[model samples]
Target: MHNDDLSRFFSENMAVDGELSFQQWEGKVLDFAQRVSRGNCKGLALVSSGGTSVPLEMNAVRFVTNFSTGSRGAGLVEDLVVREWACILLHSESAQLPFRRVMDNMDTERFFTELMAPEKSSAVASIVGTYSKYKTRLLLVPYRTVVDYLYLLRLITVAVCHRAECLRTMPMVLLAAAAVSDYFIPRTLLSEHKISSNDGMTVHFSCVPKVLNVLSDIWHTADCDVSRLFVTFKLETHDEMLETKALKNLTLYNCDLVVANKLQEYKERVVMYWRDTPGSPTVLQRPPNGSIESLIVDCILRRIECDATGGGRS
Candidate 1:
């Protein structure tokens, strides 16, 4: 994407409805990144989760969204926190959250009743204690719309770039697991009010810019020695196109790794294409007792460690 296009996109979309002002959100991210830089953490991971919505009208009564529960991203953050890594989680407001999904399967009434019961008090304590342990290391930033997601993501990278000196010695990874919308109706094109349901409606959608391109070409090249690794995900329905698309994304985006999953088998298997290990795609299977995210995080950290030790790409 051209710089002009990006500038125009942000200029038009950044002012959309949000709970926090852009300046306030930027400050939050900066403060969190600074804390991570000063702490004795294993590394820093900027993880994006969930699906974004594209509003059909300026009033936004109706929108288009995808089926991303953010389970993988939430699981990755949980695993990263367990390994002592500082994480900045940029997620959809409605996405599944780390540590909170443990009891997500239970009915709300039953969950509360069980928690208040003497027998399940220990479970409550365990959950609370785990969140407390990592509260200082994990930062949660929530967004709803595609515009919000892109804006927050850019804000985060810029903040980290600003703290480059303090974070120079640490490994940084950008994990883009969010299932973002591929098309959106820009503010200029959206109707001022919600469309009436009396008749069928036809809406035109503009293509959302390829954010990975911007991330790789701009954010990753910030003037610093921060060892930044960019990883993106590809979800495909066709099994035959999985590896090919994953490799294509790895090269096209200048990413360090691409994690590809099939819609049907994503919970059970993934194919990873590593930049350093060309032509050898690794297939990862979920362990019987653990999540696939745990394995993915292990692979990421190992690659980061290898690079740090001069065993991988410089």
Candidate 2:
């Protein structure tokens, strides 16, 4: 979008106070703004979950999708909420939720088959009940298409970027684990009707614009404040390519940290690379007594705490 268009876009979205999701999101941002203005609340986060789909037809019967169960993102939300952090969860419409699905099925490997057991009924009910009671703490916004995700992300990113009006500025963290599509057929070139299989068609693909540079530079709580921290995840199956791609992402996107994980061993291990740390990367192993998800949550929380204390330098 052009400069005027982007400015108008932000203005139009910032005016949306009646929408329930926007209201919930705005409430968290506004509260954090107030608290940070008084040096009270410290951490605020925006999390994106699930994979984005690229529609191949204007009618939208079929589409190309990316690979993601959204389990990691959902788990992050669950842990962050229980730790009393304000989070905005932007997830796919078809994705599993943190408390409702992830909590009910603690055995992530086996899926929800355990919940089908008669002995687990009460435990499941208790978790759902608790979520329903405190659901207001989470601002869940669902997006199906890639376009929808990008638009909503732009809106939320701009909305939370208010000027730090006091001595303290709240630490804003972006934990983007969503699997977005690499290429798609633009809407203008999409077929209006379904193509017949008898006539084989060769589809053309175009690159989807990566917005991390725009995010790091334009999306901020204040001008030249350096208060926002971005943490991105890199998944690769090729062992030789993992470190190169992860480090490339950090440099290319201008993010604060890049997590490199092999697709096969992601759940068991991950290496965290800090932007300012020039030497050894932190190698995190999943605890035998606990899960890797919990360990990651703790690491992120500690980083946020450090950022809040050091005026957003962590």
Best by TM-score: 1
Span of ten consecutive residues with least summed lDDT in model 1: 14-23
Candidate lDDT scores, in order, read 0.84, 0.70
TM per candidate comes to: 0.93, 0.79
Tell me, what's the RMSD of every candidate? Answer: 2.1, 5.3
Per-residue alpha-carbon lDDT of model 1 for 18-65, expressed as tens digits? 525755877777777778778889888999999999988887899899
Model 2: per-residue Cα lDDT over 1-314, one tens digit each: 34355445344432244334444555555554465445333456788999999877866787889968888788788777666666678899878787877464467644466546656567666777767754655677788777667667766676676433432345667888888888877666888887667987788988766776666665543453535778888899996698888878888878788878998998899888888872567889988877777788787777766665675533
In candidate 1, the residue pairs with backbone N, CA or C atoms under 3 Å apart (3 or more residues apart, or in different chains) clash, namely none
lDDT of 1 at 75: 92
Best-performing candidate as measured by lDDT? 1
Model 2 RMSD in angstroms: 5.3
Query: What is the alpha-carbon lDDT for the whole of candidate 1?
Result: 0.84
Which stretches of candidate 1 lie above 4 Å from their native place?
Answer: 16-20, 119-124
